[model samples]
Target: MASITSSGLGSGLNVNDIISQLMEIESQPLTKLQDKAKEAQAKISAIGTLQGALSTFQGRVLSLSSASAYKSLKGSLADTTIGTVSTAVNAQAGSYSLAVTQLAQAHKLKSQSFSSVNAPVGTGSMTIQFGTYDDKGTSGNAADDTFEVNGDKGALTIEIDSTNNTLTGLRDAINAKKAGVTATIVNDGSGYRLLLSSSDSGKANSLKITTDDADGNDTDTAGLSRFSYDPLGTKNLTQTQAAQNAEFQLDGIAISKSSNTVTDVLQGVTLTLQKVSARDTNNAPVATSLNISRDTSGVKTAVEDFVKSYNEFVKSVEGLSFYNKDDNSAGLLNGDYVIRSMQSSIRSTLNQGLGSGSYYQSLGAVGVSFDDKGNMTLDSTKLQKALDTRPEDVASLFAVNGVTSDARVSYVSSTAATQVGSFGVSISSPATRGNFSGLAVANGPITIAEGDNDMLMVAVDGASSGQIKLSPGSYATPAALAAEIQSKINGDSRLKDANAAVTVSYNATSGKFEMSSNKYGAKSNVQITATGSATEATLGFKVAQGGTGSDVVGTINGEPAKGDGQVLTGSGKAEGLKLTITGDTAGEYGTIGFSRGFASKLDQTVTSMLSDNGLLRSRIDGLNRDLKNIGAQGNTVTRRLEDIEKRYRAQFTALDVQIATMNSTSTYLSQQLSMLNNLASGNKK
Candidate 1:
């Protein structure tokens, strides 16, 4: 019969206000939990910021840490119109005076004019060969100018039937074949003409097409034979351009090549002939001088970048570790040991000496220094002067060079080895290979044939093995026969795949034949078995017992070294020490100079810091753990606040009910007392 009453309704004591005040006091732990969560989240965000900055800084550091960074070379031509030059990091810095007398040209031929592109010339098979031609218009010797086509990909034949007898059809058919030559139809004002040209530049790649039509009338100029071009025979097609070699002079030395792009002529240099050199007043070729110089620009930019990156990184670190003066507040990462350790490690790497017998060992020696504010500064003038005077020394300042005591032995690794400084190399026994000795014979012709005289043998190397077969051939001399055998062994696909090779040689003075395996070690050996009448005695091969290969014996710094063929490697104190000793040396031959350049050390430091298990990652992991703990504390505080609020409401409700009951009791007592007083008064009257 009654509605639910409010907490303080009956008491009139403002129980709701009192409960609210008590609940406010109880929520203090929740506020602390919220503040702790915010702090943990802030720390996690700060770590993320640090990780990104460090990764970017590490990337910038890597830009200057490689050999390619320091070995940049720029090639410039005096007259770029004559030709353009390109260079690699390994290109030597020098001036090359080039006089391009002639540029390589491909052969081009045009057919006689026809009525239209759709006109049928007849159907036949066309054989396109390659050769060189002269510009004299007269047919030259075909044998001398003819180029032998490789059966695999060099030679190609196209069939022309009634479907592709037209000029346009022929062009499409040739294009689809992807032959070495391309055919196009040129429509002059009067009629159309079929033009054929070689796809490649060089005298050896000239095009010569021969046709055998269905009419069997090659002499007729109207049939498909009209496309036939034989310099020594029929010449239906007119030679518009003749194939020629590229002729040029480098530093006044005459050089001729089959192609315009000449790479083998110069070490680490590729000369591309664009046009013939212009002639001067005296009729002499005007040389286009190419100046190849070390590109110090990249090095300069790298140094500047290093300074900028280092300064920025240092600023970020200082900002995170700084104490706010206005609010008297410390930063999230203030006084962190990892930050201090990182700063120290970076500074040490920058300050350490190369110790590789270099004139300039430290960054300060090369014009790099840190100021009082901890900002990196570079002296441009000093850096440029050092680069110009002794550029190699400047390079060595940032890159380590593996120098050797003797020119015979040198270190190959620059960073793989952790053991720095010099290490000694000693050779005791020279490397040797397995072989079979042949009978002493004359230098005249030798007969190698199939059937009864066929030679067969097996090459062994670990689990990989293959057979050696010699075909029937007549070699004019014993050396020729040895060469034949060597070629056969090398041409075997299985042996080539297994890296097993044999070297055959014949000595005229000693009258001895030697067949030796190219690989050296106890794991490698050669066994010769007789096949047909080709026994060991007949072919001069010791089949029963073959020669055993031996590994090279050597020591690195008096410690036993491992040997594989001619290469000797060391471990432990002489780790990553590699050398090639083909013969025995009495004692210590040389010392391998091992030095960790500044860039290399910096690279290693940055890599370690940026790795997954790095200091930055570990710090982030710790921050994440704190955040998770803060989340749990927040939930616990929320639950505790809920329980406290419920208890406060129940206590205030009971107090209101008890106050209402006391009021009712007091009213009843007063009414009863009043009735008693009235009755006593009436009785007295």
Candidate 2:
């Protein structure tokens, strides 16, 4: 509620305007404070912008520092129509003559045509087995040894019952099981038939289905045995496609695989067979030339990215810190010692060359240069030529990866050791993961009656702990119950703290419950104990084989080292260094070298600069502090201005009231004197 008081009306002067002008003068300090606050805010924002640019630059540096960026490999096929190929980073540059003979295929079987898809096959049970068969008419079961149940891998079985007696129902049931076979209904011209095919494309994954009728008769027409398929016995289902392995000749050496995609056939190379090599005029298989070579374009792009990122960073820094001579003004970060020091440090690091003993030791040699304005440029032609002629030298310019010179030895990771030196690796014993199997039962699954609950406790590497509850059910025919046990142990919340899990499997061949830990090392083991109403002895949870895993025994730089599973860590001379050993190269010894190339050094420097205690973060923090102080100062000045304005308004209002009272008094005096004068004139008249 503001009072309507015209202060200047009585005094014949604009006192309100006069007070406004005086208050403006009094607020000069406040204006200055606001200006300073604006400057502080701009400085803080500028630092944020600079930080973002530096982060981008750091990311680019990290990209170039990675080993895969330099070790990338590309595969080329002479005949593109024949097949496509890809190579891993460790693949060597070479050419190989390949002749793909045949493509691998999954085993496809079709049942005899029926009147309708909804026709019932009968009530009973059908057992599907996966294994390879021969021409001897004597079938053998080998897939049972390798089938996996739940997290446990072993032989598998799928049961068909009266609930899924129809062809369509059976198809759906089989698909739900996710077993090694896929079932579909094929409608031929005559009628509809159920087609079953192996999911995997390997000879060892052939399918054989046997059925037992409800009447206990093998010749029941309406029973599920009508759909039985046995290569040596019943033949209700005929093989439309044979289960065979993909065979090929690489460099005149014969090779075969169960799948069209051949990975292990070549070191670090995967070949997907599209079709058999086309025949030549002479009817001989055409040889396709496969070449594996270093990918220079990838490395070149990485360098270009680094250059782009570096220039952007430089622009940001200059924009924030430069002094403008034309305007005689300083940038947001002008005269900041920390920023200047950072610039100097970055330039110095770049100037220091790497690869002292190599032919190409610096960025300049690899065709990366900085101009007078401090912007980096790339000479693509020169860089490509260097990569083409001396690729190893070019790679060393960025990072020198420790090459596994020995054919038998493989390199893993290196830490705690010098990143630019060489060390010797000698392995005595390769690491092995622990595996334990329970006592083998007979041919069928061991059943538990209703209310017969069993609790299995587990420990892995003395780290993880978990308990699995086995429910009562008939497990002999279908093997899905074993999967439930695996889920309980693996999905337990309490066991997550151990950082390990135990896989449960039912070995169909051995008829035993197998449990293995998820880790590899001498201390890694899965100890099982049946508690509550169930005992280990009765449940046959006794370990039949495999209790403890073996740690990798190796030496680094001739100093004794400790091995945890597949990792080898060095001590003394190789202190702070560790390496991972993969593959089955036990007892293999080799020298591993490490080098932090130009990119790696730059990456480390930039990372430090962006760290919490780095120059950039510290500067940003200081600017934030300045901004906060400026806000505080602004608040103080504003409070003072408010007080001054209030005092001026009060004084001006008082003056207006006094001047108005004087005018009223003078008016009254004049009026009274005028009246007296009028009376005197009237009397004289």
Best by TM-score: 2
After superposition on all CA atoms, what RMSD does each candidate show versus the true structure? 7.5, 8.8
In model 2, which runs have C-alpha deviations exceeding 4 angstroms?
A: 1-5, 123-132, 136-154, 212-214, 217-222, 341-345, 348-362, 385-421, 433-520, 523-547, 555-562, 569-578, 582-588, 595-624, 649-685
Worst 10 residues of 1 by lDDT: 146-155
As a TM-score, model 2 comes out at 0.73
Tens-digit lDDT track for model 2 on 1-685? 2333876766778876888899889888878877877877787788788778888888888777766666678998998877889988767889999998888898899988888989887766565655555553244543233322233212233456667778888788778766567899978899998999888786755666667677677544456777777665566777899887888888988887878888897788999888888888998788989999888887898889999989988888888888979998878888877678889888888887553324566788878998988899999998888987866556657763555446555555455345455667788788877777777655565566434445666666675444445544445442444564665566444555555677777788887767787788887776764344543443557422447888888887788889888787878656656677775656647776555677777877878887999887787788778778878887898898888888887777777677778777889999999999999999999
Steric clash count of candidate 2: 10
Shift in Å, residue 560, candidate 1? 3.1
Evaluated against the true structure, the overall lDDT of model 2 is 0.72
- How far off is residue 636 in model 2, in Å? 2.8
